[model samples]
Target: MVKSELEKLGLHFTNIDLGVIEIKETISKEQKQKLKSNLAVSGLELLDDHKSILVDKIKNVIIEMVHYSDELPKVNYSDYISEKLGYDYTYLSNLFSEVKGITIQHFIINHKIERAKELILYDELNLTEISYRLHYSSVAHLSNQFKKVTGQSPTFYKKIGKKRKSNLENL
Candidate 1:
């Protein structure tokens, strides 16, 4: 639908991905205005500033790698992000920290914990498997971080998941 709208507006886009778009040609101010207005009507807002766009791209990359990818990278995440975005790791780190007020590493850890919770709830993988899947050094390490973030062990979280499912079934 979004691509269709861009096409209808006579914009030539080379690529479109989550939160990012590539236009084949420069768009006029009128075209941009029309595109923004059209997108707003559909509850989507175009990113107007460079910093906001970069921040969003950083977030998208992290989410994709940590939560959606089948395997974690062999390289460090900072190196991966820098290589992917073609920016210096230090600069990216500083910009992300300044704009989001949280270090990128912290954000990655939070996301990893969230993904761990999801895998635990799914009951498809055990703690050791989850540990390796998320690229944790060891099961003990995964547990420590899980406890630090959620104040609950993975075992307790799984029990909670079971109880929640049972409650839903009762309803």
Candidate 2:
């Protein structure tokens, strides 16, 4: 979708991926504005500012790791995010909190809890399995986080159907 939009504007790019686009040439202000407008039509926003771009990158990496990866990495998340973005964990955490108004750890926990809700809704995984899949240390920990975040238990969520689940984008 994004690639086609860029092509429509006659822009050249060396690479494009989730949360990142590398144009082959510098685009003028008008061209950037046009591209932003075009992308907005598809519910996408261009992040040209350095801090916003980095924050978006942080969100993307966390989202992918939490919601998409088959297995969560075993390393500490701060270490993982820092290594992934090549910035000090403190720097990234401060910038993320300053811009998004939430700590990185809080963001990851929200995503983890949401993913757990999704798995619970599927009815294919028990709480223990869901905890394991989400890399929680134990079922109790997962249940605690789930209850803290959603005001309900995982079992309650399973019995309640789909209303309690959150759309990933909204988080």
Candidate 3:
């Protein structure tokens, strides 16, 4: 759908994946605005701002690390992020903190915890496997972090799952 739309505007896109479109030729302002408007009609905004780009890169890196990668990197996260972004870890950290109002570490932990919840809900891997997959030092460490964020143990949360639907009349 997106590829056809781009072609309709006489743009040659080498790649059109999800939110990305790779065009080889430079486009005029009118063409750019037309493309932007077309995309906006379908609820996609073109973000060309440098700060937004950097912030998005930071988020994508963390998301890929936590959710998609088969194995967590052996190196510390700071080194991993620096290598991935080709920028000093400190600079990335400062920029992320300023824009997102949280440290990168916190962001990573939040993703990890969400993954942990999904794994627990899936009822496939044991806590030990999950801890190792996510690179927590131990099950105890994972439990502590999960409890800290959720106010409940992972086991307790999983067991609770969802209560039978409540009735408003019962109130």
Model 3: residue 6 alpha-carbon error in angstroms: 2.3
Q: What is the lDDT of residue 121 in candidate 3?
A: 81
lDDT score, candidate 1: 0.94
lDDT by residue for model 1 (19-89), tens: 77899998889999999999999999888789889888899899999999989999999999999999998
Kindly report which residue stretches of model 2 are placed more than 4 angstroms away from their true locations once superposed. 1-10, 162-171
Best-to-worst ranking by TM-score: 1, 2, 3
| lDDT tens digits, residue span 29-144, model 3 | 88889888898898877766777678788899899999999699999999998999899999999999998999999999999999999888887899999999999999999999
Of the candidates numbered 2 and 3, which has the greater lDDT value? 2
Report lDDT (CA) for all predictions: 0.94, 0.91, 0.87
TM-score for all models, in order of appearance? 0.86, 0.85, 0.81
Candidate 1 ranges with C-alpha deviation above 4 Å? 7-17, 24-31
TM-score of 2: 0.85
Considering only N, C-alpha and C atoms within 3 Å, which residue pairs clash in candidate 1?
A: none
Candidate 3 residue 79 Cα shift, in angstroms, is 1.2
- Cα RMSD for candidate 2? 5.2
